[model samples]
Target: MSIKITGTGSYIPNVITKNADFHQHEFYNIDGSTFPGDNESTIQKFKAITGIKERRYLDDNLNTSEMAIIAAQKAIEASGIDPETLDYIIVAHNYGDVKFNCHQSDTVPSMATRVKHHLRIKNPSCVGYDVLFGCPGWIEGLIQAQAFIRAGMAKKCLVIGAEALSRVVDKHDRDSMIFSDGAGAAVLESSEEKGGILAHESATYAYNEANYIYFGKSNNAEAPQDLRYIKMNGRKIYEFALVNVPKAMKSCLEKSGKSIKDLKKIFIHQANEKMDDAIIKRFYNLHGLDVPEYVTPMTIQELGNSSVATVPTLLDLVINGEIENQELKDGDVMIFASVGAGMNINAVVYQY
Candidate 1:
């Protein structure tokens, strides 16, 4: 038996925020000092490094759980599965649901419970829970689902990654422009298929990197003493990812009994274009191979970094033929990888 991703779905918000939108906003350094140079030059440098021209933000009326519900519905529909038959519902996220202009994160009932409730699944045995593993959360959710199936604890599961990052960002911080809001989901089930998830690798380097990404007071020091927003040490994260992520991916692929040449595509977290490009190059170098053209499909150029939502969202788009020149075919070998807060990193070697 194999655990296969039977269906995939994603919710890309309708609100398009262009880079030019920040041109008039005040930018500040992490130490609350005035940002050097003007907004145009700042944005240009940002674009050159990250390749993000625009991003999507959740509408004011919707929250992260609501977006999860939508993506879950689509996945359920695509899978043609009865909602009541699901054995587990896993929602991955960082900040629960932060209402527009609200600083508090609502996770009392848990995002998974909220999704199951909104999906209207009445089965009491369909356990619902949340996983807080940072941007790799969704991929981690998939790994968990596979474990449950392999252990005979579940037959079918729904895994979702959703976030309203726009609501958690500090406008005064330039990194705020790198964040957006979205959700993605997939249905996993045990099947007699020959190829599915072959292997996975996960790690947390919190000893010295625990604070690479964290919540801190806004760049505007005088804004509030008690309130905090999502923040990160960009240079630290980039350096850390380059050193560690490729090794994890290589380990996973090796465990799958597959060679580097077998990989058809790589679905990596949409954090930064340059960072991802560097990771992929290093990944191939480990195998003494050159990076293949179009081996990686990216949505980051338009969708920005939506944390947990990036990998699954990219998979959903490619599988549905929404991304030009990128397609997933049966019998294709692929790698899914991500790195984020918790100083965490994970990779899954899957056969489509």
Candidate 2:
């Protein structure tokens, strides 16, 4: 069984955050870690060091659910599927509505359950839930949706990767400046087609010590603290991506009986411009193509890092002409890869 992506859509808040924007914000360190900068431009070296330009974000009037709602609506229109016909709607959100309408904390179901009500999804019986994963959440949910579609459990599934990363950013930290808020959606439907998520594979590196790179779990003890803001150890994440991401991409390609040469395009994760640069430099020499030549590197400096939202958002950007020269077309093999804070990395192969 195969799943066809009938439609694709994405959203980034109107608020654009540049290096200057972050510098203007206050810096607070409850743990007493000295924040090392005065203004945004002073940290321009850090951006150059990290290789990011800018990232998009939502201002006061915005939040993750709102972005997700916008993207999902666009995806519904692109998919040509009425919202009411949806059988399952799964959101890959680190924290969509942290500043809830009433409550202090946000739960997966709390926001996901309302997609139908808010969008007036035609079928209220459709199951809508949130799948909690780090940066790799999009691919993971995609695989699950494929299973549901194959088993006849769902006629159509609307999967969204939305993250409100700024809510948790340690503003004073320079390494955290790249995080942002955005949303992306893809509609999966049963298909007899050959392409579209032909092979999906993943790997995890759970180093006992490095696990601290990106680690936050909901205590659910009494009040769920700020578990939604994505965090990371930038240096450690870079190491993990350099070592494991290439191997994971290979593992997925091998599963499909293909190699890097056969791929028309590899849509690697867009967390940073450097990761793709390192991958191409280490893996294969994409002749006549730059490392980021095929990649839609979403600049984290402005939008911040939207965690799981990065890859899919970039994908939609390509489709919508936001990305130059290259756009998504049929028979293109895209490799999805991500390195989250838990020192976790996952790679999957999807052919579109």
Candidate 3:
């Protein structure tokens, strides 16, 4: 049996924040001290590099699980499957339900459990849980769903990646612009059909631990002395993705016995456009093929990096005709890849 993605859905916050908004605000270093710079030039450079012009942010009253419920409901509706029939719900997220401007977050009941409750799923047999794998969490969840289906442990599963990153981002830090709030979900069901998930690969780099995100007081500028926010070594992550992501994608494609020519499009994580382009070019070069920009669709320019939600959201948009110049057909091969905080990287090859 193979795990088929029967439906896809995504929800992005209605509030749009422009990159230029940060220019009016003062930035702070880790130690709560002010940092001075040409704000306009800095923002310009940021946009030139990341290709992020704006992003969505959930209202202060909302949380990650709520966004996930919206996405999950859409996926279930599209799949024409009853919530009661869902065998499992695997929620992929880094931070749990965190309130805006609040440092405390609660993970006790798990985000998946919260989603199941919000969706009014009454079946006690419908197991729910959360997966924490940095940005690869959703794809990793799909991989697990594939295993469950093959092992006869589940017949249907809801895989979701939701993040309220704005809750954790430090407004005074430049990194805040790269984080946003959104959710994406997919309905995976056991199918006798040959085209579904063909192959997948996942791995971590312990040596790059320093590149991961962590909560700590600002070290560069004084931003209230005790304020803790999401922090990471951006340069390290950029370098790591340039080197590791393509290798993982290549490995996944090889494992599926599919060449780059067989792929219709690659739905890679919407982390950084330049980095993603570089990675894809490197992958094609390794195989002696020219880089094809048309095969790689991107949403980062508008959606920013919604962490794990990036790939699934991009996939949903493209498959539903919401994305310009992109479409997926029956039996078309597609690849999904992501890299994030754990220095974790993963890729999945699927038949659409």
Q: Report every candidate's CA lDDT.
A: 0.96, 0.69, 0.88
TM-score rank, highest first? Answer: 1, 3, 2
- lDDT of candidate 1 over 301-350, digit per residue (tens): 99999999999899999999999999988999999999999999999999
Model 2 lDDT-worst window of ten: 215-224
Displacement of the residue 65 alpha carbon in candidate 1, Å: 0.2
Candidate 2's error at 160, in angstroms?
0.3
CA RMSD, predictions in order: 0.6, 4.4, 1.5
The estimated TM-scores of all candidates read 0.99, 0.85, 0.96
User: lDDT: which is higher, 1 or 2?
Assistant: 1
Best of the candidates, lDDT = 1
Expressed as tens digits, the lDDT of each residue in 63-170 for candidate 3 is: 999999999999999899988999999999999999877788879889999999989889999999999999999999999998888898999999999998888887
lDDT, candidate 1, equals 0.96
Candidate 1: residue 33 lDDT (0-100): 100
Tens-digit lDDT string for candidate 2 (1-352): 6677888898877776666556665543434344455656556776776566677667767667777888889999999987888888888876557562333346655556766567887666688888776778877778788889888899799988888776765454455677778888889998778787767776556755355454343222222454433446566677767777777776777897775666766666667766657875665543343454554344454555677788778778777878657776788777777766545566667778
